[model samples]
Target: MTESSALPGLPRRLLADPEMISACASRDFARIFQLAKRRGGFHSSRIARTCELTPSRVGEVISGKRKITNMTVIERIADGLRIPGHLLGLASRDWERAEIPTQPQPNAAMRRLAELQNAHTTVPSRELDDILAIAAGSKVTPTVLRSLQVSIEDYWRRDDEHGGEALRPAVIGQLRYVTGILQDTADPNYRRSLHGIAAELARLTGWTYFDARQYSTARTYFTESLRLAREIDDRTFIADVLACLSLQATYQDRAKDAVTLARAAQDSARLDGGTPRLMAMLSIREAFGHASAHNREATHSAINEAVHHFEHVNPEDHDPTWVQYFDRTKLTVDTGTALGQLGDAAAAEPLIAEALQAEPTTNIRARAFHTFWLARTQLQCSKVELACATATEALDLATIVESPRVLTHLREFRQLLGSHRTIPAAVELVARISETAN
Candidate 1:
């Protein structure tokens, strides 16, 4: 049930797949485990320690005793192995569904019809009409027809990803068609749909770069997305882009830039009578700025305001699918971290507990931040045993995601732990943190 012998160097996509496939398509557990182990840079001892698994258990997986059937387990393995989860088929998302039919081959006439249908509308409807007219008399070859269909599909795919290349001019040219349609259309519903597509496409371009940690490219994409959002008069999306810009600023430690962007977002939302959600988001940005400056009073005030706004904001009020993700619990989690940084563990503990209890499924990065703060709070309170455990958990998650922000927080945690070197457990955890740092 293994293709490892037949295909020694299969692409990473195939190496990472966990789903059941057609006959003759299967994975070699032993080969995959070895590959993961080699890529992860871990010996047996290190692997066992990080995964909290027994040495025997790790050996069994490597020897193919245990099948890699569990998604969580596979993710854990990838993390421990230091392999990019996406490259290893441990991606947290599914690929886009293809539009073309997936089945047995069609007959010659059916294939011809498909090719004609795939022809770009930008080629001129009249030109297509003329081609169809000519095709009505002459027979087309299946080879030529299939090639045309593939070219058409490729154009659309490229358009979806990067607005298409010059060879795919018809696809990019559709942007003009969209704009023209918007101008002539009077139906609000159609305009809304068109604007929504533009926003999604624009955001996807930015997300590709942002997720890859290419900040400069992401900034440009976000700026372009914001411009399109303005053209469509979508205030929510406009605010979202502003929030993203502020996020970039925060990541770069430009607190003043973040504050300026957040204030601009607040002004725009105010014109529309600032909803609870928008106000909470703006306040969150302000909190970030205050926290960066270590201004306890200002940070607390902004965080408290955010919590107040979040409590009243109905998740149903937002039309943007992403906006509904915000909640009071998450805002409080952030507030707790800010409070802890400002040396208010007494004020921070309760909020951290509430956030932990909420069991939020969204925003792992934010949760990681909260966990880092909780660890700091425990350390400051002389609870070395508990602090070390919390710090380890935060470090593990941060390591899995390769987040610089989380690593920075870990550095801070290490500094705190280093000051209290008497506890053996704390010292061991600090060693682990140091190993990861190197």
Candidate 2:
């Protein structure tokens, strides 16, 4: 392959950068993830929501089981990392020609796809682009983008917050419709264009199953989402999926799996100089796995790494859309809890307190974890009354999110408080949580 005789559209320096290789190897995912976490501010839970990719999928790509062929997906990942297409040595039209396999059994894939798409159907990209152009060209106050985000967030959260079974089918229908559309589009670029939607649908589907406690189906959707993300070459989305997978692994007591997935997620982040949001999430998730395994040193290191990334974020440098859940307060909360788990009650107390006091509502998820940790810390400090209060708060927050993750914390907190049976409130809270757990 002479330089002059190279692929017509390929860039001269495409193969020059070792970063792409590093990306494929997943070697630098942790650093890249840190960058993304800082840039996008994504938390582990919100990474999928904002990035429109399954967190578990991040690992699949790093493990090289998932191959990336779509230029658009690569571009999207590059875009999320704020890297130029030319820098990745991609030709202008390569993304358009990138091959992605539609399901061999189109009928089944389409039916499944259509069910997913119809649930969250939106105006075509052409229409969206036109509106965006107008907004860019003129002073448009009523931008549709903001409206779309809010609406989508609401739609995304609806079923999870309320156990409404009726809406599930409708949502699934939307997913199937979108999947069908991707499968039906004749244009080669169709898969690339559909990548974002596909990732989003897969994520929503996975979340639905996760919330419903259907772990197996949730894992399947997450895996599918990860495959599509790689076909599209979107590493950040891939990282998001890996995070989800890690969460599931942790929830299921698959600590080693969680650690392995977290490492992969970190690699994906490193490959593209990933968003700061993803970085913090990967670190925090690593902390979770380490904590679960009782690896205090590793947990502390992960927490510290997460904190370092959180301090260096610049919102203006980000992709201007998605990512944006990571922040200092959240990192502090995570760090504090991790420390608490390592038995550093003194160090953990201030971090959790500060996090809880700062933007409490925004910290609902953080508080859930922190409250549980705080309870433990209080117990360690022999503040039984404070421990009981913290335990109750944790349980209440867990009830609100219907998270088994949080429920597990509630159970642990209950057991801790149960040792001090003299307190009626503690006894009652423990009983309530025990019943809920059963």
Candidate 3:
């Protein structure tokens, strides 16, 4: 908070400058270096040495031709220049703790923390002062944890209304940051919250990949999320990850695996004392698995159980944040989708139609997904013109959504309409679909 001095290198007056603070807040490293050079005595070569970067890199940064993103370099810049940790979203540095009795010396815990961090992180930093800061348990304030939660929740909201294709970079970056901190963090108490935050972020990252239809990448993140959740013994979150895996399995047509995963999710949720909404969510996945496997009896059994659970759901019941989305609209949509997969075109059409009609207009991603399902049911029922019209509506939303999952289902519906190609509406729909591809 005070003026920057020799080791924490920038001058006090320069640090207090409004432009300096704004640039640091936005991480405009080029602007930061330019200001440092002009206001502080930091020429490019000196800046390069201070921040553990090359002179050429420093020049590029000052010229606004490149931006610094690597955590290691950012940490060095913060430490070498003694920037306030809060300005850069880092832990308080050793220099900031000058008045306190110095436990800043590298002890066994700090060394071990550094080694583990180096082994796990691709962007490993040379500065271990923050490791000492972690050893002192100075990073990851409650506010920081809460901020992480808010960020993940915001990402979820955006993914719901819009799609995850545009958000994958930010979500994955956040996951990696939390993961790295978790790997080096020494305090058990801090580790617990870190792991919980990491789990949620990993799960969110997986969901983004799932929406992008990158099954392998999504599975990797899902598995990482499950591992973190288990480490924290967060049964509610554990069940959510398993449900995600189950849904991904169903998407990949691995029906048996989906069934197994859904059952695992149900078991985990039961351990946490399952809420009706939670049960209903997992049960629908089980139904999806059964339907995908062509097991009509099992599929209907699961669907019936889902409906029963939904009927028992109390809106006031305290369900997990993830389970809050499984309201009546979701239940109806899933049931219809499962029924359609089970080859009951007549039964599926009405439920999907009702769901499509009931869904909020602003929930473009969900609307796109549901509209395609409704279109598929219409096609199966030989309502060719109606199906084409429905598909076109979904196509419009899909363009806005950019979700591979929505487009994937739309492609399947198009293929199903192949038999009716001679129909004028079908021909027109094919041309429209072609336009989207272009």
Candidate 4:
């Protein structure tokens, strides 16, 4: 049976579907094609024909071999499939205005949600624009919940590899939609799961903004994350959000607030019977907070505690999904980063090198960040030549990665190099960096 109507495009039922809606939100057309086939009675040939794509290209997308990114191509897909332009983060299509009267009128929430999703938008880019839009979801279902969960994971993975600057639109857009549905939803069997979904989305939206160094907007989302977590009484994720806030505080140079937030997170984790990796991640954050305060003794103590907790982590422990990044590699690099802040280059260098060696090539952002830290540690030990060389590599990566925060770190490091500015190696690195500004 056709889920759509007489038009040669997709049906209204598919557009309203949680699974398809999630796919469209992220522009995962392979999933979209698959869903259309499975749920909307549309085949690859049909999608290809309507979207102005080749059958072979459609096949590659379905098999995960390609992604569609051109704005024009995306618009064609939106129009050909009769999808609303707002859903794809595009301006309204001519066809949308021509949509027949039999087609349901889209409300303000849908239109405004589309407005905020535009990366070039004049909109304020807030997380929630219309409360009624959030309340406009269909009855919650397991399938709907599962589809959103996967998208969230994908967003984090992408952020890890390339940073979050480009992901803001999709992340924030889905968050607004999901959070609205969550508040208005009262499902007895799936209510808590929905809250978990909303909490994580809010946390991720906050994180993308954090990665961009927009602290004010980031705090609003993090605050929302905490509230949603509290609704579900999920202490693990609650602690996670607190740790994130603590890290943000460290960045903002609020050492006292940083330490206080870290400790509060730790206390909450303990009450939840924390996992080893969770405790390890929090401990390092605590260590960083102390280093910011210039408390040498407390810094080392927390470092020791972090290492101790990490040693106890086992694959079977079933750590919360959020702490999956806290593997030995992460623990090692983070420990090195915290120690570097304390100016203990001798203790920090080898650990950081090990982390860089094991770091996956796909995560360019992490490599760039850790490479810069390595240079700083080298500088701390007074290895001016080696530090300059390593810093040059960091500059290369920083140029390509989409993080302003990494560039900011590079600026701070340049100030630290003022005394060495006259050195030959330092001079060349400085000139190279200066060229980027030009």
Highest TM-score among the candidates is held by which one?
A: 4
Name the 10 consecutive residues with the lowest summed lDDT in model 3. Answer: 126-135
Q: Which stretches of candidate 3 lie over 4 Å from their true place?
A: 1-138, 184-187
Per-model TM-score on C-alpha atoms: 0.57, 0.61, 0.69, 0.77
59-97: candidate 4 lDDT, tens digit per residue: 999987777878988887887788888777788887778
Ranking by lDDT: 4, 3, 2, 1
Candidate 3, 220-334: lDDT as tens digits: 9999999998988999889889999999998888999999999999999899889999999999999999999999999999999999999999978899777888889889999
Report the CA-based lDDT of candidate 1 relative to the real structure. 0.60
lDDT measured at residue 332 in model 1 versus the true structure, 0 to 100: 72
Q: Which is better, 1 or 4, measured by TM-score?
A: 4
Give the clash total for candidate 1: 2
Instruction: Compare the candidates by lDDT and give the number of the best one.
Output: 4
Task: Judge candidate 3 at residue 420 and give its lDDT.
Answer: 92
lDDT-wise, the better of 2 and 3 is 3
Query: Between candidates 1 and 3, which one is better according to TM-score?
Result: 3
Candidate 2 displacement at residue 307 in angstroms? 2.1
> What is candidate 1's lDDT per residue for 52-137, written digit by digit as tens?
56788878877745545566665554444433433334453221132246553579877666676677333334422233324333
